[model samples]
Target chain A: MRLEKCWFCSSTVYPGHGIQFVRNDAKIFRFCRSKCHKNFKMKRNPRKVKWTKAFRRLHGKDMTQDSTFEFERKRNRPERYDRNVTMETLKAIKKIDKIRVAREARHHKMRMKGKKGIEQKAAERELEQGISLVKAPLALREESSLTLSKIKVKVSQPQAEYQMEE
Target chain B: MAAFVASKWSKVGPPLLDNLRSSRLLEPFGKFQDIASPGWNGLLFQQLRTFIQMRTKLKVVDNSGAKWVRCIQALKGRKGARLGDTIIASVQEAQPRGKVKKGEVVYGVVVRAAMQRGRCDGSEIRFDDNAVVLVNKQGEPIGTRIFGPVPHELRRKKHLKILTLAEHIA
Candidate 1:
């Protein structure tokens, strides 16, 4: 039997436990428990929930970026750790943590700076709105004047290969 | 001390009535499946890949190519869409003066796909052809008639009326 990670919590999911949802695209999502499945059904983001591992990783709580946690880092110094050297290290760490606190506050503001795109900002824009471009003032929307905003035009790169002048 | 403590209880205000953070409509779709991750399982059919791109022309399978559709957007920014995705499309070819006319932009939900979709239960699902059902601006199917199989996801989205009209549900 193969082991899978729970889609919501990022925990190990053994077979015979947890429910799975296969989207129409055939992408499978396996959840470890009813709580995770219910959270998925209710449209909850695992990255937003404080309890999940996704939240830890997404918000940089992954211990990799938690500079304060460096005090308990796995790396060992090659030389002997003397009392004075250790004390100096501790003092430097204390000062670093103080700086990190201020840096984190600045990062928090920067992370919240950007806005979502206009289309996704509203949930039911398509359902509530009509096609304004199609129903133009003129019949058949005169080809030259038609502003097809949604349709993307194919841009050919002519400059990629150039002919040498004789 | 007892008189002073009793007076403080009256000074406190009652709890607020309305809950401020209960908005659910901000999300475009619930149960979104991420197909852009490192490796997306297996091959998504090539025809289905081009079936719903910008300026893609689709023949109404049930109608035998009589009606044509040109896809605009896949509703999500993923650039391409798969089965059960709703697309904004314009009717390029339809019966003259019919219920749906040429040049009318409408919402079409993909009911079938040539792409093989896999289930969580280790089973694979594939359809023979690509198909769609036109829906109104309200996300409900326009006509009372549906030609072919529809997905259970659509029914779960409260498009039960469309299922009642469809021949089958996959």
Candidate 2:
């Protein structure tokens, strides 16, 4: 079975669903639903319908310009379906997603490094106010770098530091 | 249910018409006066959104000969639509021999909204029910003749072409 992309929405049209409109010039236009079919029959412009993906892409809303989307390459036939190749492609996509997730976690930690300093300052101020605060489990660990840093902070502030703060 | 009033009042249509009444008094400082000298009086605005806010399967008064229209979009936030707002509606009941076919979505502009709308002069005007006029993207009314009295506000917004085709403006 072959899948076709809808002319208006550019979504995949399954075998039993969607409509096909044949123009006077023998060109066929496929629509994914009755909504798209009706809009096309009414001669409505795709650009004016803000809900359609075509409108989103035309207006440049987070849509990337893929190489296959090039006007000249549009007519190029898709490669024939191969079961083995499809399986390999699926595995490759999953591997890429795993790598992407790990990279994003690293980037998040890097972004939060500066924010942590600000948070620690607030936590230290609260500690000076005699407020009983529960430290995070990671901070409670004796050998953790965060706990070592906290001890260093306590040692730096002496009786003279308390006098200066008031 | 229809109730007949005593014929002592001057005969126009009746003492109580449901809608589409004409009140022609201009109040002080350019505000439109509601009917006040009353045994039974008329209303100025014939349509408003609060009365019949745009909803699916709601009846539409089409002067263009389509018997029914189904509103698809009420535009701004869907809480309700107001006068001069654009809407998308589908023709539900159309004659087989009419200009528009059934299931065709047409652009409609709110000619009258039920909510009281404030004018530039700090005065407000409201209509009896929510009403829309089918128009093209160029803002031209598709109907040859508007069914009832049109408001001057439609013309004030530069829709003079609709005013030219209208039989009366109130």
Candidate 3:
């Protein structure tokens, strides 16, 4: 059975699942679920919607260009089936899957490499700007040295606290 | 002047004679009229591939109360009806309080056919079920709302009202 990709989310739509729409122009659009179909009916652009694969790909949030994806493409020309070839292909699928998973993890890590530093910097800036919210400005000046050290501790503390809250 | 006339005749006469011979050959089969008609050549091939024959049960895809309709006749040709073709049908089942009643004969337009139809873009489309939208003699759809996807072929068939009322145009 051939698996189709959802037009909106880019999720796999297996046979006997999802809805297929063939436009008057004969462009086939397969939706993974009613949610995708509804979004399409509303004329929402997949690239503009943040949840869609097109959005993630367009915004560089997901891997758009990758050789691993080439294997999953539809091949109209049929390959001559042989017992040995089929057996080899079955074995290769597992190896390919492992490689693809590792590559995806690496891609995700690369995308998120500087995210922690950027988030920390933004938090620090916000804390500096909103320092008066936590402590009065007049009192901060009197205890500036003590508060600076306390603030540093508080910055690290909040992150741990946030994780605990989650 | 005779030589010029002969040259002119030489250019057109053989083709006209060939056309006459072909028409005469096809006349016994009763398809010559369809072949000779302007703009019918395209539809002639389509008619051969059409699947909705007389008595074919089609799902009514409009809110007009018809649930199922049995085709009584194909409006366009004798063979069968394809996508975007008009057909005369009798409502087999319908909503009791709906606009139309059971056994009511109505004019309808084929919106989606179970048979695969090829498009200009080299793609083929086939729907899960054969469907039709109830229309009046004026070719205006009886239903204000169309429930499912309608093909673009309807637009070419001049069924713009049905297209506008459709939920989706696939």
Which candidate's lDDT is highest? 3
> Candidates' DockQ values?
0.01, 0.00, 0.02
Q: Write the per-residue lDDT of candidate 1 for residues B73-148, one digit (tens) a residue.
A: 7886475666677788888888764678888888887777665444455433445556677887787777667675
lDDT of 2: 0.55
| Candidates by DockQ, descending order | 3, 1, 2
- Write out the backbone clash pairs for model 2: B47-B129, B48-B113, B48-B114, B48-B129, B48-B130, B49-B113, B49-B114
What lDDT score goes with residue A90 in model 3?
Answer: 93
Query: What CAPRI grade goes to candidate 1?
Result: incorrect
Better of 1 and 3 by DockQ: 3
lDDT of 3 by residue, B66-157 (tens): 99999999988667988788999999999989999999999999898867666554445566568899999999989899887888878888
Model 1: per-residue lDDT, tens digit, A1-166? Answer: 4667888998877766766654544466778887786577566789888899989877765433766656544444465869999899888988888877777777666655653444343422442222222242233124423333322131113212222211
A27-52: candidate 2 lDDT, tens digit per residue: 45777786776576556677777777
DockQ of 3: 0.02
Question: TM-score of chain A for candidate 1?
Answer: 0.38
Q: Could you give me the TM-score of model 3 versus the true structure?
A: 0.48
lDDT of 2 by residue, B53-91 (tens): 455443344466566677777766556555566678888
The number of the candidate with the highest DockQ is: 3
